[model samples]
Target: MSKKSYRNKIEIAKEKEKNKEELLKKIERLQKRINDLEKSLNKPQNIQDKTELYLKHPEEPVVTPTLKKTVVNEQILWEINNSQRATKGLFEIKGNYEKICSIIPNALIIADEKGKIIFWNKAAEKIFGYTSEEALNNDLLNILVPSEYHQFFKEGFNRFKDTGEGPIIEKPSEFIAKKKNGNNFPIEITLSAIEVDEKWYSVAIIRDISEHKRIEESLIQTHQKLEGMLNNAVNTLVKIIELRDSYTSGHQKRVSELAVAIARKMGLNEKKVKLIKIAALVHDIGKVGIPSEILNKPTKLTDLEFNLIQTHPQAGYNILKEVDFPWPVEEIILQHHERIDGSGYPRKLKDDEIMVEARIIAVADVVEAMSSHRPYRPGLGIKKALEEISQNRGILYDPKVVDICLQLFREKKFKF
Candidate 1:
């Protein structure tokens, strides 16, 4: 080739090399711009002014200098805002939890799976007489639990560590705990379990129930005394009724016994049964107004005499209506003679009109009156009394009460 032609080829090669160098520099500048964009996207932005402006005028456009009215990567901005909000929420939750643990009235204790105390609150310090600093790092069983219960606690803790469950978790348990002063007292503890970073923690809420126990015991004693006094008053009223009718000496007492048994057999609650018994004991109180001659007469009662006798229930009501009784004593006394089919006396009250206690007493009254020897007639046999009730099951008496009464006689062999 000629020397001039070779030099021309070299010039073409140099021009190509210079163009390639300029292209590389432009590419490097573009890469630097991309890096600047990424940095700007990642760096935390002051969103307070923008947020306030947007909230104040939601329909207006945000024109903040930091965001610069240019289109930017929205996903990165959203992630940044979300992360900040999540971090704020987590910190708020932590602060609230600490506040709650500090202010709760009951002693709060937190321990790891190994029973090492991790958190002890102010209430615990007050209750166990140990400062929070003193309780931390101490074994919970050794510090709070009595020596006798240490083995039991250990067993429960082991079981809880394996299964995250124990008999004491999620339930309130009462037991004795020793204070720092060596005095033992009753404590109620509720335990809960939590998992943090793949580790188990136990939280115990303890309440010293000494005052509550003392108050409960005192209330029980007061209730017992009141019950005894009420029972004495009932006995005195029963005696008063007995004195009025000497011939039927223990009739009221026997009726009361049968009524109580029937009430219990009918599944009536204790309060209802008690009311029925007391009302039955004084059911004949109205008979006190009846002339002793009519009550003791051995002959059949004349129409006028029977009519007068029928008024005894109302007379008894009149006497008891003014007296205050927790039970419906006055109403039961007036309605005992009432039949379910409106055939009974005084008001001829139908089924639902009669008080439940009165219906129970009516069945008991009939059974006792039939089985016992009345002044006017010989005593009917128990079989005959049962037969009478069985025959009149629902017509004149409550079928359920009658059935219970019959069962008492046949199945339970109940006797006066």
Candidate 2:
């Protein structure tokens, strides 16, 4: 407002304008010197003369003795501002990178070391039903992770932030995640660690596995249906054969139960155990071809009638060989009567010549038949039955099968 102050303001503005002009002039002079130096180098005589007056241009800037070369000042200006240009380019690249993240099918989320979400892509929005705007700056724990697992994950996340270590980093694991609408579903998540400004950040790729789970469950149900049908067919066949002699069918059911327990106690896998069970269930299926009067004969039979009973194994094999089974059910039934030594009837299969399923069924069949009461004889006690297998462990039965059978009865308390 004072006259002297106003005049001083005008002088300051003039000084700045003059400085700007001088800077521009210096740039122009530098460019001209470069042009003249280039022209001098192009001359044919200038190369041959090797003159001390290398620069023909009189307007060339003076080189101070402290510096042997006169450097390009404009080049220095470009170098000084190079980072400014680079910052602009980097900004553009950041946008393109974000576009790529958005287009990926899996949800991409970047959360800071403190577990605060900094980035959420389009797929993240779709999967969690939360827009990027809503998810950004939110706590990753509260937004997506189930509340019940909050403490479990909070501890892990804190550990990750401090030491850049956790069980989940770089590992793909399945977990349950909650959506915005308060429904929970399965998700497969993979996490990666990145360091920025001496701080750890998590880059997570999340995928919805709801559809996969549905498909898996559907497959399991279909398998169960097929299994039920197979079981029903086996039961119907067993019932048909049992119609001739009730004692034989009841004996078969108890044998199958004991066989399954023995197989499992031996740590045989499910498929083999399953085959053993089915084979034991139908071990007497050949009796359907035998005359009912012979099967139901209450008194001790003659040697010829006993030979007729032994024919049931081969006959049962013949009966079932035409039917398709997942395993060697027919062969197993045929070999059930064969002993481990070269003594038993039919093919007289010796040790290792018989299938292991048959060997297991042989032990189980002996135990259950001896333990149950017969129509003509009192049931031998379980003590006597165990002693029978113990006496015949290596000679007539598989050693492993006999040991497991003994353990099942004595320790595991398995029963028919």
Candidate 3:
């Protein structure tokens, strides 16, 4: 019961240890197979099949053809290695592209080469007032394109199919489109193309631009109304000045005409010319504050009277400053009497300090005042008026403005 029993117990322990070692080897092999399977899942199955062939026959070279194109099936493989689901093969998992189209805010419509709608997104349904079921497999022209544009769209589509290009592809274009409710509205569309298995498919990104168009039209109408009101107000102000001084009833009107012509001759834009004309029409508005006796004195005025006359510009500025104008009307009135050398009245603004509209008006004012009949003096004629501006071109008047004024009278035969 001593040495023999001990030996038998040692043999039993050795057998158990050997069995454990074999089981450990089997577990290692199983882990290596799992790792290989994971690596194969990441690679293309066709490439993996070729790799296996090369590994099995090391002496023979495997000639695999290079793949120039790939066909992406919409179907997704959900259960690759699961035995229970393998019988179902690869099933579609509800394509990502279809989901994206359904969720986007803008309308998306996909069509075949014959203009037959294949896919209509949710946004398309909302925009065109048509359900996806109603639009699918239908002719796009009959459903969405307005009757007036059917022929044009058909011609363009034919051209696009032949050349794989069109005026609307990859570029946004606006067109009048019809909805399911039979309402026609403006729409902006961007088109793109994709080739699938040798068949060309067109995708259209659409947006309803009816609201934008309405907003643009409204702004234009408001702008026109505001312009009309401004013109009426300006005419009323000119009439007020005329009422105060009967002798200068037509003086402002004549100055405005000449100022506009001179501005055009100087290559000023229409907007600037309009501003200059308006300022010239009311340039002497401050004269309404002067006494009638002083304005129509018919003789040389005294020093105090002359000083009072110089204050008209400042008074005109004060009167207009409270009113809001797109152009600097108040500043133009204040600076119209200013000179290039800072020798004029009121603020005595110099050169660039004076508003350009004011500078243009100053030249027109001198020419008109000198040529027209004033109560204090006789009409001096156009020749003398031209000489006055030509003599003091750079000193009293803007040189460019003076040159343009002279050219207008001499070359263009400009008349008030």
| Best model per TM-score | 1
Write one digit per residue (lDDT tens) for candidate 2, span 1-416: 33355456546634533442233234334433434434443455433242333333123343322222344333322222234443454454455556556556678787888899988889899999999899999999998999999999999998888766689876678899999999999998877665444577777778887866675676678778778988998999888877778888999999999999888888899999999888998998998877777776779978998888889999999989998786899999999989988677689999999998999999999998798897658899888999999999999989999999999889857977
Clashing pairs in 1: none
lDDT of 3 by residue, 1-416 (tens): 23355456546634433442233223223322333344445555564464554355333111111112323221123224443232233121224335445555568787887889987889899899989999999999999988888899999899766554788876678899999999999988877664433455666778787866675676678778878998998888988887888656588888889889888878899999989888888888888889989998999999999999999899888888887777888888899899999999887789999888899999989999999888878899999999999999999999999999998878867986
Candidate 1 stretches with Cα past 4 Å from truth are 1-97, 146-158, 172-175, 321-323
Model 2 / residue 65 / CA error / Å: 57
Residue 30 error, candidate 2, Å: 39
TM-score of each: 0.71, 0.70, 0.69
Cα distance off (Å), candidate 3, residue 102: 3.2
List where candidate 3 sits over 4 angstroms from the true fold: 1-94, 110-118, 136-143, 147-173, 190-203, 264-270
Tell me the deviation in Å of residue 69 in model 3: 16
Candidate 3 lDDT at 28 equals: 27
lDDT per residue for candidate 1 within 277-339, as digits (tens), equals: 888888888888788999999999999999999998899899888876767788999999999
Residue runs of model 2 more than 4 Å from their true location after superposition = 1-81, 88-92, 99-103, 269-275, 298-308, 321-328, 341-355, 373-381, 411-416
